[model samples]
Target: MSGTELMEKPAAPAKLGRAIPPAFQGKQFPLLAVIVFLALFPPLIQSDAYDLGLLNNVLIYSLLTLGFYWCFALAGQFTFAVFGMYAVGAYVSVWAARHLGGFWSGLVAAVVVTAAIGALTKLAFARCSEIYFAIATMALGSLIVILFREWTSFTGGYEGVSDIAVPSIFGYQLISGQSKYYLGLGILAVLLLLTVLFFRSPVARDLAFARDKGPVAAVTGLKPVRLQLMGFAVGSGIQGAAGSLYAHGSGFFSVEAFNIDLSLLVLLMLLLGGMVSMYGAIIGAVILVYLPEFLRDASKYAEVIYALAILVIIVAFPRGIAGLRHTLGRLVRRA
Candidate 1:
């Protein structure tokens, strides 16, 4: 065929029904299953308040971890300021709810403030990359923690903020464990859906391209900095939302809740779950959250066991638990 004819000809059709689109490939089924399970879970465990509480917490932190995955893993920004953003969201929400007369206002304020700060943070560190960027963000996160501790008038200082308002809608309070569980699960499901949708969108495509192939992305007319900042801002805002939910659910929070330790823990969760997959964040959050409870009776050995498990998972499954299915499939096919 002539070159023009060959170029004009439609590309060969993908194998019928086998060419899964990027949006749904390897993602929809598992997430759908999890969503269904979570949606139906609260009713099933109505009597098990303790377990419901744990599930609620898992949902809260999962949102934070997923936000981490968005900025750090997907956008390729090496930032650890998510914890700081979380604190800001929680404090702002609490303060707003108390002073502004409602939860809706607090929620909006938290998301807007946190997102603006995230964008500013990205701008401040626009020149830094890799380790330097990570260090800068970490330092900022720690500074935020200190600020929270020192700003007694605002954050309640060392004593922390207590008796923060619980979630209420139309004068209806969600006081019961089951109610909170559903609320958290609902928020988490929505955020997770948004995260996944973002991953499948053109923006995420460009961000991923910029992250993995900066030179090519630039050559293709993509603006890496803009995309990175968008990721950072959106991710931080998501963390902020998670934090607001956490504060309302718990009715109290201190600077300690958003310290560097929490940052590290959440980061570890991202790593152990698999940075490449959004589902990894969920798996990591569940395991880390539940493992502590499961090993609580071990007392002194609990931490050691936890550390050992992390090491084992990191060593044995470098790509994280999310990648295990692919690994097993490969081995089976080879055999």
Candidate 2:
């Protein structure tokens, strides 16, 4: 055949592979399975109130670490103000619950107030470098804690607030550990879904571009400041919600609970779980929370062990547990 005719000839049909089942095609099945498992977990374990409370603690810390992940990993906004936001959320929710309407109104107020504070903080430090911004936030967090301590009328002062009402919905109070656990789990699930959606959206892309190439992004007409502010607001709002849940669940909280140590712990959780992976936050929180319990007998060595573990993780698995999982997955594929 002439070269032109050969060129015009149809190629042989590509080999057809077996069609993959719809259920296994995407993340939907896995996600649903996870949700179902978590929903049924307490019942499956036959956990007592204490165990349920520990699980609730895990969920709370997971939310806090997720907020850290949103601010630092996703938005590239280095911050140490999470505990401050947490404190503000708890106090605001409690105060609003007493004076305004009820638990629900307080929760809303906490989110809104924290979001505004986060946005304003970012706006105020719009021109600062990341390190400076982090320092400013840390300072602001300290200030907030101090404010809560001295402003007794607002936060019950140094004595702290012990009259936090039991969170209720439709006149049904979440007074039991099991009920509270479910509430926290539901909130975490919703936030996790939202986080996934945010990762897949244009806003995430724009934020990434702005974060990694600020000048270039600005040149291209992207407002990096605004995007960063939005990220901060969302992250802070999440922390606030977590704090509000914590206050109602615990029924009491002091300034001591929102100290720098708590902030560092949240950071450690994020780092240990894999800063870039959303699942890492939950993993990290679970491990850290439970590890301390196991080490309580040797309390003196706990801090040392934690330090060593962090060092080893940083040196050996820089990306944390989630990164290790990815590596294992790749190795399995290769094998």
Clashing pairs in 2: 152-157
Error of 2 at 50 (Å): 2.5
Tens-digit lDDT track for model 2 on 1-335? 11011122334434485544221223633663575476657634856877887888999999888888778876789899998999999999998998887898888998899989989998998889999999999999999999889898777776789988888878999888888888888888888877766654457667877877889999999998888789888888889998999999998788888988888989889888887567778889988988878788889999898778778887777778767855666778999
> Each prediction's TM-score against the native?
0.88, 0.87
Model 2, residue 231: distance off in Å is: 0.8
* Collision count for each candidate, in order: 0, 1
Local distance difference test values of all predictions, in order: 0.78, 0.80
Model 1 deviation from the true structure expressed as Cα RMSD, one decimal place = 6.0
Query: What shift in Å separates residue 197 of candidate 1 from its native position after superposition?
Result: 2.1
TM-score, prediction 2: 0.87
C-alpha root-mean-square deviation, each candidate: 6.0, 8.7
